[model samples]
Target: MPELPEVEGVVRDLRPIVEGKTIAQVALSETVFTSHDAGKQTIVKNNEPHQFERLIQQMTIIELKRRSKYIFFQLEKDGETFHLINHLGMTGAWFVVNDITEITEDKFRKHIHAVFTLTTGELLVFSDIRRFGELRFIKEIEEHPPLLKMAPEPFDEDACDFFITQSEKPKYRNKPIKEVIMDGQVISGCGNIYATESLFKMNIHPGRKTNRISRERKQQLFQVICDVLQESINSGGSTISDYRSINGGAGTMQHRLKMYGKKQCLTCDTTTKSIVIAGRTSTYCPKCQR
Candidate 1:
């Protein structure tokens, strides 16, 4: 799945292309993409963009922000309001094209799931072969249930609060730290890949009880999550053999991973093993992580 870093990269690449441009087209080809906003009409070729233009043609993109793995676009008007939200689940990607001709067969014919044409003549295309991504509009951004339910993100105060709460939660008292972190309610944006990487980096056993971890270990774990997330963003996020950035480029972070998917520890050259935590495979150097 595309994590926070991968999604943030997409937001970065999309800002200049569609920031000031009006919506010439809002076309969605997949039904699953509508799951983000209940009852949103599936965007066909000619239906919604005209209506969308009446609603938001001259409006400017005031800000672009992210919550967890979801990218939120704050579009503003003096008298009207609308928000654009995007979620790239597994195989989703965005494409920026100066012209429709710039959109290649691989981007349009093969994987294209949605397209948002900007007034500037540029095309912001969304493609997800897995049909797990989402593009939706909302009246008040804060009213969206999914976004509202999300805990604090990487740098927010809510994240720190969530960390402390999760550490004390009775349900997690005997559960492995990996399982604890994998729960989105406990820590948003931590998918299986990051959960494993975070645990390995902190030298914590995946099966260790969350409540039993030491204060030093908690501090180390917190910093590693931030470090790993920032590093992944710099590398455009791990491709995970599926996701790509907004430029349709594969991420390079996978090559720098220390623990996940390796048969041996790259840092210490110790033999590694995989263990199942909450039904997901986690790899660690038994010698190092214990």
Candidate 2:
């Protein structure tokens, strides 16, 4: 899954190309973007193919932003505004291409399900092999329950405080620190890969209970998470699998990974230990991490 850095890269890449430009055409090859909240799969939530076409075509993209792992497209036409919220679940990606024939990657070629041609003469293509990606067009983002319930962005001034307060809560105190940080409602945008790296860097065991750790340690871990995420973004985000930038460039962060999928500890030279937490594989240096 594309986490904060990856999603932020997409937002930054897309903002320049899509914002202030009207969409010229919207084409779907039987494409359906789903919403876990409504459990419906049309183009977006309630809009059918034709309806979605009518709603988005010719609307100028006002802005593009990222919250957690979601990409937001602010659209407007005739003084009416609507938000297109996209979650690139699992294998989903957006590509900028001048022509579909320019695509050479086999995964993107095979999974090019939706195409949004902009009036600027460029094309925005969406490819998702697993179909777990979501694109919803709504009046406002917070109106959606799932989006509404999301924690503040990790860069928010109060995000660390929120994490600490949530960690000290009765329900989360007993939870593993790995799971606590991975929770979207607790700390948005840090997922399994980033959390594992953060824990390893902070010398904290992934399975350490939240309450067992001191408040100072928790604050340190939060800072480590931010550093790891920022580093990944600087490297264009990790291409753990098929993650790519809008220009179809792969991220180099995977080459710099210290944990997550390592066999031997780079620091202590001890064999790494692995566990399943929050339904994701977490690897840590046994001798290095406490």
Total clashing residue pairs per candidate?
0, 0
User: lDDT of all the models against the reference?
Assistant: 0.72, 0.85
Candidate 2 collision pairs:
none
Question: How far is each candidate from the true structure, as Cα RMSD in Å?
Answer: 4.0, 2.6
**Against the true structure, whose TM-score is highest?**
2
Residue pairs that clash (backbone atoms under 3 angstroms), model 1 = none
Give the TM-scores of the predictions, in the order they appear.
0.83, 0.93
Lowest lDDT 10-mer window, candidate 2?
29-38
lDDT for each residue of candidate 2 in 1-290, tens digit (9 for 90 to 100): 89999898888877877788888888765545333234555435545755676778988889899989998898998999999888888877888889987878888778876788999889888888777777788897667888887889888999999999999999899999999999999999999899999999989999999898999999999999999999998988998777777867778888988987899998888999998987888899888887
Candidate 1 lDDT over residue span 192-258, tens digit each = 7777788888888888888779756776787788788888889888887657776657778888888
